[model samples]
Target: MSFTQQLHQAAQNIWQKSLVHPFITELQSGQLPLTKFRFYLLQDRYYLVEFSKFHHLLAEQAGNPQIKKFLLQSEADLRACEWSVRSDFFTGLKITPMEIRQTAVAPTAYNYVNHMYLTLERDGFAPAIAAIVPCYWLYQEIGQKLAKVGSPVALYQTWIDTYDSDWYEVNVTHILQLINILASQATATDRQMMQTAFIRSSYYELQFWQMAYAKERW
Candidate 1:
């Protein structure tokens, strides 16, 4: 399969295994709670910062000029998310910056993202991109679903606000563009390696979310 096709397929697999099949049933029933929604928002806020940091490292290491630019743009996008979370916290919504920061660095998801970055920084850009794809694609898919589900449904609005924002969309587009460029530069063997890494990373992403949601158990 072409690189884009492979990426899409991997993403579809993740959605099927993680969000679409699992949450769609609950969401369709409109039975998910506000506390759970809040927990998701808080969890996401913590995660995005780590993502931004990882992209910053990638931007610095990127051999391809286009990929470099995309990484830089992604950093900006992450910052915008940070700002939005702060806004949400300051609005008297019971959200706090410390809580977000603490959760971001929590042992489970935080450590996983950190390990992915370390692997990428140590291994190569291809591996790093592979490690990162699940986070990007999964967030996009979830955001789209939440958007369909509408607001005040327990974390739906906060999620919509974060994931559907211009900053988030731009980052997603840039990552896809970077992947396309990377695929073009890679030989068949390298492309295969990237594909494997992408699949593994995507699975890890699902695991992280599942773990986080389970831990919160709202």
Candidate 2:
């Protein structure tokens, strides 16, 4: 099995919880409150801002030219995606940049972004890649599944469609391949750090949903 496949297996339980989380299920059913989704969008805007920076930082550290190029491209894509989400949902919901700026980052998103930064600081590239991959993988997985059972709400369906596209899948596959390549050359200790980073990121994925559902503060 590929290294990412093993990481997926190890984190399957956490991923499953995220899939079945009430926040997700409610969104799927088109029963999720707009207030909750708006809160989510705001916090997500914060997360994606830092997430793009994380990619740029990772790209700087990448020794492989291919990987560095991919990371830089991914950073651009992430910035565009973040803006697209903001344009679509924020305008649709009448959320303002002022409001988003005024809002504080929720704990889940703050911790999740910090976790990625800390992983890079302490463990370097491989583990940092592992930490970020769940954001890509889980969204595509959720989007594909939710596309099959699409939301009646156009907004929710639009969100699902964003991740469900073939282009998004290709980007995700590229990163997973990178993971496998890194794992092949990684020391046993580095591999274990990667595994731990993957699991923690997966767990954070689950918490992000809960935070949205509760519109968590502080």
Candidate 3:
């Protein structure tokens, strides 16, 4: 199996739970409370900032020029998406930068980003890729599925369409390809570490949805 396929297999249960999580289901149905979504947006804005740092650090450590280029472009795309798309989400939801600044990071998001940072710090390239891909790949998968069924809410649909796009898919595919290449060269121990990182990140994805749905604090 391809490295990414194996990572998916290992984390399949977590991914399934994420897909069926109330936040996602309610989002697809457009019955999700805007209050809940507002909390999510606030937390997500924090996440995007940390995510850019993770991307830059990973790219800086990547020895391969192609991988570095892809990581940089992926970070750029994330910035563009946040500015052009999520800025409207912030405005329409009446979320202010001050509110985002004032809000403390929810435990789930705080721990989740820390997990990525720690993995990158300790394990460097291959493992860091495994740690981070779940965020992009899982969201793209969710977006693709939800896009077909679609949310009645325009804002939610816009969110879905943002992830379910050609550009996003191409980035994900490139990452998957890179993962396989890295895996082929990885030792057995290294491969196991990568798998563990992937699964842990996947579990965090499920927790994140639950946190937002419950408006988890502290």
Candidate 4:
């Protein structure tokens, strides 16, 4: 199998579990308590900000114009997404910036974001990209799947729409193309590292949802 295919296979179990996770199932049914989602949205900011940082760091290291452009775009998109989460979404709910600032990061969210930082800082592009791809691909997978289920809640519906937008395919295609290019040039050892990074990140994806489900704190 191609490396991307292999990566998908490696993460397949995690993806399946994530799809049926209590948090996701509740989200799809629009039965998730608002308090849980509130805490989740508040805590997610911690992850998104760090995610933007990793993209900016990658953009700095990118030599290829396309890679650089994509990384910069990714960073910009993440920042905008964060703003939407904090401003448009939260403001609609009357959550002030001060409130968000006061919200503590959940332990799993902290670990996941920190994992991205360490993986990108310590690894080459192949493994670094592998480490981050799950966040993009997994959310897209969950979002699109949830989009197919009609939710009574507007917030739940809009959240699904945002993540399931058509642009996700374009971004996924571009990133997969980049991954194929990187994989072609990678040594077996590098490939193994990439696989390891993918698995670890995928595991964290599962934990993140579980955290949201449990409304974990500290």
Candidate 1 TM-score to native: 0.78
> Please, what are the lDDT tens digits per residue for candidate 2 over residues 107-191?
9999999999999999989999999999999999999989998999999989999899877888899999999999999999999
TM-score of every model? 0.78, 0.98, 0.97, 0.94
Q: What is the C-alpha lDDT of each candidate?
A: 0.66, 0.92, 0.90, 0.82
Which of the numbered candidates is closest to the native, going by highest TM-score? 2
- Displacement of the residue 154 alpha carbon in candidate 2, Å: 0.2
Model 1 lDDT-worst window of ten: 20-29
Global local distance difference test of model 1 = 0.66
Residues 125-171, model 3: lDDT tens digits:
78988988898899999999999899999999999998899988987
Best by lDDT: 2
lDDT of 1 by residue, 1-218 (tens): 65767877856766577665334334434565445445555665667657777788888888768778877876786676655665654454676657655653445556567667766756678867867876776777777776775655444456455666676777777677778778888888777767767776676666655554565432
Better of 2 and 3 by lDDT: 2
- Model 4, position 182, has a per-residue lDDT of 87
Q: Order the candidates by TM-score, highest first — what do you get?
A: 2, 3, 4, 1
